[model samples]
Target chain A: MTFARILQVFKKEMIELRRDKWARFRLVIPPIIQILVFGYAATFEVFGVSTAVLDLDHTQESRDLVSRFVYSDRFQIVKIARNQQEIVDGIDDSDAAIAIVIHPGFAQLLRKGQTAPVQVIVDGTNSNTALIALGYMNEIAATFSRDYMTDHLQRTRDGPPLRGALVTLEQRPWYNSGLNSRWFFVPGVIGTLVLTMIVNLTSFAIVREREVGTLEQIMVTPIQPVEFILGKTFPFFLIGLGEVVLIAGVGTLWFGIPFVGNPLVLLLGTSLFLLSTLAIGLLISTLCMTQQQAFATNFFVVNPLFTLSGFSFPITSMPTVLQWLSYLNPLRYYLVIIRATFLKGVGLSVLWPDMLALAAIGSTLLAVSILRFRKSLD
Target chain B: MSAPDKPKIRVAGLTKRFVGTTAVEGATFDIARGEIFGLVGPDGAGKTTVMRMLAGVMRPDAGSIEIDDVDVVADPEQAKLHLSYMPQRFGLYEDLTVDENIRFYADLFEVPRKLRDERTGPLLAASNMEAFRRRLAGQLSGGMKQKLGLICSLIHTPQVLLLDEPTTGVDPVSRRDFWRILYSLRESGVTILISTAYLDEAERCTRLALFHEGRLRYCDTPKRLKALMPGTLLAITSTAARDLHKALLGRDGVMSVMLVGDGVHAVVDDADRRVPELSAALDAGKIPHGELVRVTPSIEDLFVGLLKDEHAS
Candidate 1:
């Protein structure tokens, strides 16, 4: 409760932090690197995809079709093969990720106003990349055929022999229309980085006290358990707040993502989320004897939380049990609140449940941590 | 606040049980003002548990711990105001500068702004850490770190100081430095209850408590504890020391033969009556042995003899 004592604790921790230069480096640099690397890598918009082409038709129409693929910037032809065997060999050997085959009758069929089939082969080793490449290939092929038919009808001065058989599918993406993965992942990175540091730092604060033999000295002092907990948890709370702001600023300014909701709400939600994560960290520390054990426990929690938090994958797509389990994950709700506020501009009236969930998690974890810490001290 | 006449620390029927194992069993002892009391025992003894209880860190299952008339069990916070505890590992922030650590503890103890510098300056000088005040604690050597731990404990200048095995892993020279600090603290009228595994170091204490298997086997001054040994100790050195030990164990009057470095010290009943027969047995075994000389019983010898007697009774 005393401000002076808390300041004293903070000062001591700062000194310890200053002494560990390597650890300080870890805290600052990794977040920046993660923000930058993940910002560039996480994108749903595919471009410059590597591909190979087998022009067995060896005709002007086939060459023109391949030129369209080249001009779209969707596919970069890495190999120009002479036959079907070469295309199969290239894709089979993993030298090219995708392969295009123009059949021998492709030019004749197009001239006769008949349907011409262009076969696209893709590697499914990494299904996500493979699926995105397939999506681009389908779009390219459909557009090329539609334009070719329109030009053919204009040149012949007659209507096409067959009426339109291909049905047009209208795509309306919800939430993020452009599917800018950076807009989604950059904000999520803020949560991931802040939670990682806050939880890890706060948990180690008390546990390290026990390891270094300082906890006994602190316990023997007039400082109460709550005071000790507050003292240990407060610094990390501030650090977490700083991290959130830093990542948010970078996301908005550098990555061109919008921050549409109230900053106060964002701050409050993140603070509550930080409290819960830190509490979980401290609880783990109490159950562990060594720093290695605490670190390993943190890892065990972090992997599951990140996977189930709906950051990279849609929680709705998960199994029913996993979807329900995501409700128990603090990151799930926080990510929702953050993305909604930053992207959707949703207000507290709409996001109150997430806020309440965070508050509940924070208080429960804090209470349990204090009880366990006090029990261990006694 | 307690009256001046009351003992600084008083523990009666104090016991500590961990799960199914008893760590301390009905330990009753009192340390008067300004005394350096040593709690000596081999590893796994309950010395640390008793110290922790008195320091108000661990609650005893039974009995009361009063520090300067403040009931430690009832109000641990009040008891803390009168005592300082340095655990075995001497918890220190390796990253913090020496001066920062001192300031931190001093601030935690609520030391007055005006007098803080006066109290800390002397401690810094006494521990010879003034030059390295700006250096991190982790950068200091083992002895220096121990010295810094003592300094932090003494920052508030509590009435009693409880150090749990402060010298367990310290080198011999650092152990001496640590003891020197303890003596200085003693001169300053600080009541110190230190636990240690080194028997020779126990000789430095004003009073001693020999603990084993969670029980206080004996509690008295060092001299009195040594005198409690039931039998005379005779040291026999020979070229065939092992054979002499084996042969002497068969002698009727010999109670025990403990190998002491190069020789074996035998605990026997009536040294005069047993000396000739012991020499004859050594001669029969073809082991060349020297004269049996009676020496003063060391704490080690006394403790072993006491355990033997306790087992027999």
Candidate 2:
């Protein structure tokens, strides 16, 4: 391949891309906006869940138990009801996401050293939030019971104070000490945003030329098919790298997500990821006849890729068949590498397998796309 | 015409088929050096197919094309070094400026920087587009775009230039300007092969090949092709031209009658002998006539007669 001819094609495409105002807007603005919006908005951590409480006993013990639920940041007591019917109304009217019903004998049973159960009702419409809310409530109740039994034993028994039969489990979360969901989701957003933009930019590269009649002109030159494909992909590859840096910056500075790994490793992983995405775009362009068809096909391919990449949902949560299917998605490997590097501060030794997978899939995609591109030109 | 000196371009039994249809069949021709050869035909007459094959962009199914002694099908890259093709669309990047478009082609052809700088200014001036060099190609008028396409194709200064319908949709004034540029190029000794659907433009070429239904019907100079008319042609103007046309359709000497403008053009076996019989017939039919005179046959007349013969067979 002649490098000068390839450079000419590359320069021409870059000039046109710079001059096209709509394309420039699409390339820069959407990724920035999407990264910011999805980083803060798309999270599974439930906070400030509106709660209602029905305390029928009116005792100090009952009041103490209600305070435990209110003090936890996960639940906010928005309504205090005198009867069970009021709590039901709060939940049914959607004013409260969770409701607590305390029976009149709650304090009496606890004082008699008998087990007392409190009914916790939750709205199941948003199952993830409801499940997290239930876990918080259970922990609060268990803590309240343990403290009450210890006080009773210390006050009634003599000598060294009879210790109650209780087991305490210490929980320590690693990597993300606070278990911040943004740390998990922001890196995932970077993977998804970069993939979408790069694929879109390269997907229409060739098909647009075909529709506008420029491909025929380029084909008549002495440039080979490989040179043309390289010329078409290199500019978008640079743009994809730029987007990764931009979104990663946004994730770290604006959202307070940590970037602990080596920047060079991130760069290496991103380049490999871009290779596969750009090749997929080239493959789609070869299959389509027009820009509209390319756009439609891009959407069809990108959605499934994002889903199987484990961007939002964990791959382990999917069915066995779909979990196996995720192995074929290059984005899955990239997301693993990105998230690991960002959160865990891991190096090549920890991420070598994922990096190898990315390289394998990327080179294979590039080879297939080159073959398809040559065939289409012929 | 001499066998010793090689022609600039030579084609032998060039054929092309698309899917289930034959677009061009057994076409053969030779173009001399420094001559503007025209491929003239109507739409769907395979003018584009022939131009594409000559451009070395498409392979002919059953023929050989040699350009400057290089086999185009065997080594298109070698042929491309000595030739340039401007397709029907011209494929100008709409977003790029006129100057940028020309520079792009120059770069692809690997034209030397000094040579490009020397040639670009004069080319822009020659096309009368120097004032709009910075304008985007999409914003230019259709005629100006065609001029820019010509400039881009000529930037490399190839030995052979193939243009497909360069003036098809251009305005008449721009068409005249484009031809002026072409003539200047011809004077510089560049061999040109241009295609057009307009029969009038056929007269401008040094020689032309007329195509109909993917077949080469005639290949010669415009003057020679017109001379191949089978019989005498007469132009008849009458107050009731349609009535006169209907009256002369079945006459003894009349070969064919067709309406031309507000008059009737007829081909007869012997115009001098049939004039009296025509007058008597008109008188007998009581149709008043004027300006009934024998005239030279035009290329349009020749083409129509050829089409008629093809249809008859």
Chain A TM-score across all models, in listed order: 0.89, 0.92
Question: Each candidate's lDDT (Cα)?
Answer: 0.84, 0.88
CA RMSD per model (angstroms): 3.6, 4.5
DockQ of 2: 0.53
Per-residue alpha-carbon lDDT of candidate 1 for residues B128-247, written as tens digits (9 for 90 to 100) = 778999898888988888888989888899889999888777778777777888888888899999987788888889889988999998998888888777678999887777877778
Pick the lDDT winner. Answer: 2
What does the i-RMS of model 1 come to?
1.3
**lDDT tens digits by residue: candidate 2, B1-313:** 3452778899999999989899999999989888899998778899989988888888889999998789998998899888889888888999999999999988888899899989999999988999999999999998999999999889989889999999989999889889999999999989999998777787899998988888988898888888777889898988788999899986898888888887888889987899988988899889988767988887777787777767767
CA deviation > 4 Å runs, candidate 1: A18-24, A55-68, A80-85, A101-119, A144-178, B1-8, B122-135, B169-189
Q: For residue B115, give model 1's deviation from the true position in Å.
A: 3.5
TM-score of the A chain in model 2: 0.92
When summed lDDT is taken over every stretch of 10 residues in candidate 2 chain A, the lowest stretch is A216-225
